[model samples]
Target: MTAQANTALAAEILEVPHAEAAAVTRDSRPLRLITCGSVDDGKSTLIGRLLWDTKAVKEDQAATLRRDSGSQNDLGLPDFALLLDGLQAEREQGITIDVAYRYFATDRRSFIVADTPGHEQYTRNMATGASTADLAILLVDARAGLLEQTRRHATIASLMGIKQFVLAVNKFDLVAYDRAVFDQISTDFKALALSLGVRQVTAIPMSALKGENVVYSARSVIPWYEGPTLVETLELATLRSGQSTGFRLPVQRVSRPGESFRGYQGTVAGGAVKPGDSVAILPSGQVANVKQIVTFDLVRNAAVAGDAITLVLDRQVDVARGDMIVSLDAQPQTGLAFDAQIVALQPDGIVPGKRYWLKAGSRRQRVQVEPVQQLDLKSGKWQSADMLQMNAIGKVHLSFDETAIFDPYELNRGTGAFILIDPDTNNTVAGGMITAKRTELGGLNAHEGRVILSLPADLAEQLLATELLASRRDEVETRRVTTSAARQLLDDIDG
Candidate 1:
């Protein structure tokens, strides 16, 4: 693409209402949340209520939902789940079969809620949603208390790095909104969550159908309950404050038009950027200076995390999509070998010696599964395994064909996560998180020698001729000895 077109694309992505620019920056850093539960546990209903009560739906859409209510036809509740259940089959089945993403904004924050399926068949889908989430909301039936599915969801969430959990005791109205029932469920879930290493657990008694304790506190029924409502607690929740520790922007596109302007465009994954900042382009180790920061309708002297802007460098540099722009001081390790935990979705197992495409950030590389260390779910202990089946969690060692920048998933979400794909089919097979890097023996100072050996053509010919002559001489000496023996025998006979 030309430089001008590239600059325009960047500007278009970054352009917003002046008031929205600041608001978007503050809220654009979304809180990824995943809802987990078993089928009929009201997972979909709770999500629908959260969106409806938050006033996220447009008036016309709400009117359509109201018009379409009262049928259990594929779409569960025509009013609430319709906002997220976009698929025809999902609407028909009245059950979520895959992960549904919904975006909404409140005065206090913006959220990307990942509504994951509850059935055992879609457990991998739930893991995919949970892997990138900061918090998890696990729904429990007030009548049933804690079920096996609840523990499984919580365990999966803990494994995926979700530290905060809210055990929402849903459908309290069925049990007459009893405080005793709510408290007992809360206590049971708390113990289970604690055992799973969940650091924070907040239990709330809610009735999604009744719209109680969801957006506003249900004053009449639960007068004794004084805790914050679901919306209020979410708004007050503390977010991680250390998101700006490293500089990382995966180049999405590169442009140079007639040599007038040349730069790269992508959303800032982390850290800050300013004029004269020294940045390195990954996989090539090329360095350049930030000459200017250009957006479509505005020019900025600096940009920070979440900003989408084109970076014009002082000198022409060879950069492209799949390359990372990083600060020199915080350059990530570049290599072919890395470690990751993969959650496989298909029934077809993931085996060693198989090649797959790995997409991490904006970089895509051809990767081979080197080995499967262990399956974490069945045994809860590490054991040797050959392949990962559906809904199976395993640690895999992967080797890439080219060098790529990466961070540990625990450290940086933007740089440390990736997806595995089948090269021939181009189907996404698994989602992975970089856990560690393979260390070479003898540290960084190890060395090996390189040399080549071959004989000259003339010398080779002469050696072959001399070997043939020696063989002929040996044959002649044997024949002469045989003739002498025969003559001696004849002389003895004549005597």
Candidate 2:
């Protein structure tokens, strides 16, 4: 190649499409991750090692860590857990209590790590961290192999839609770098991950305290292991793609900066939006056209999921906070009854037929919950349950007093996820996801109510052909059952 060929190649590279280039850059954007495992599984030590080796912690912070380090571990390093377990109580108790977030970077990629508490009591905090994480690092003690808490953390992470998993078999040094033990643990964990429908799992043996196989390679120590280090797996891990199903902007607030300016402000939860796109105000079904997409910087022609902007509609409409602005062609399900899966976070648990404030996005409404079943973590079976105790993952029915808006959690997490707040204490008692809209009226089509007829089969056919019933057939459900079945159903009715 000549100088002219080189110049032409440079020009071609410079002419790469802005959108395509931006997308590639976005794909490589910092990955958000969470660390979770049983208590004393060395979650903090792993995160601290990552930060320390990656040079994320500043010198002043290191000095403070040394000053705070009452005693060093056998590895001649400061108590790495101290670097993350920031609370005074946690330091005293020698366990993490709250979620500790830290940022670090390498030349290949950047990372935001949420070091969640490993104790059973702080399972709620772990869920909070998993909600926004793209990957989960589940730590396990090499000597202990897999425990119940380890199973619980993995289950929660899986339920929250984290597909990527890294099983850090920590404290390998304590187990004398036993390859057989590592293989057994990894095999069992892979089985668990497979059961959870997580196909992407990378297991590595490491001694977090000794800084082996975390940011650095422990290849010499664990000669049998040839997998990438913790940091390596993270750097190559895929970021959660923009898997939104439809355009959704849960209105956080309606902005009326001046008489001429009226805008709906919120982060785009799913899909993309641009000027002139037809949108529907959810729960109301009111339609409007986008006139402009405004941001503090400038008027944007388009905005995709995760962009926070103000949308100015072409006409005035009744829009408010908690209402979702969505694409008209693709609308979310709106119904009074829905089925959900929840993790009971409170000590008193969730009671059947109890009314709680269901808050999703920015909207809150009264809802009655009836626990249907509780998931058995060990067996992976759903046992019939009327009440869910603390840390219990249960399925339940949520009947709203008014119309509830949602998408299935599998389709769009932002639109389909919610929390139940205790009306008496105003505390968020449970985090849940909309599984599906319940269609109780048993008919070929879903309808609001059921109408059973005890007439003769011939008479029932004749009734279906009548003009009044024919015209409104879709609006009502028709069910035909034996007199004995009807009597049993009537006996089981709550009234």
Q: Judged by TM-score, which candidate is best?
A: 2
Candidates' TM-scores?
Answer: 0.76, 0.81
Local distance difference test values of all predictions, in order? 0.75, 0.84
lDDT tens readout by residue for model 1, 191-250: 777655564776778887767888879878977566557775565445543263577888
Poorest lDDT segment (10 consecutive residues) of candidate 2: 1-10
- Candidate 2 residues lying further than 4 Å off, grouped into runs, are 1-28, 443-495
Off by over 4 Å in 1: 1-30, 58-68, 71-88, 91-93, 195-197, 238-244, 371-383, 442-495
TM accuracy, model 1: 0.76
The top-ranked prediction according to lDDT is: 2
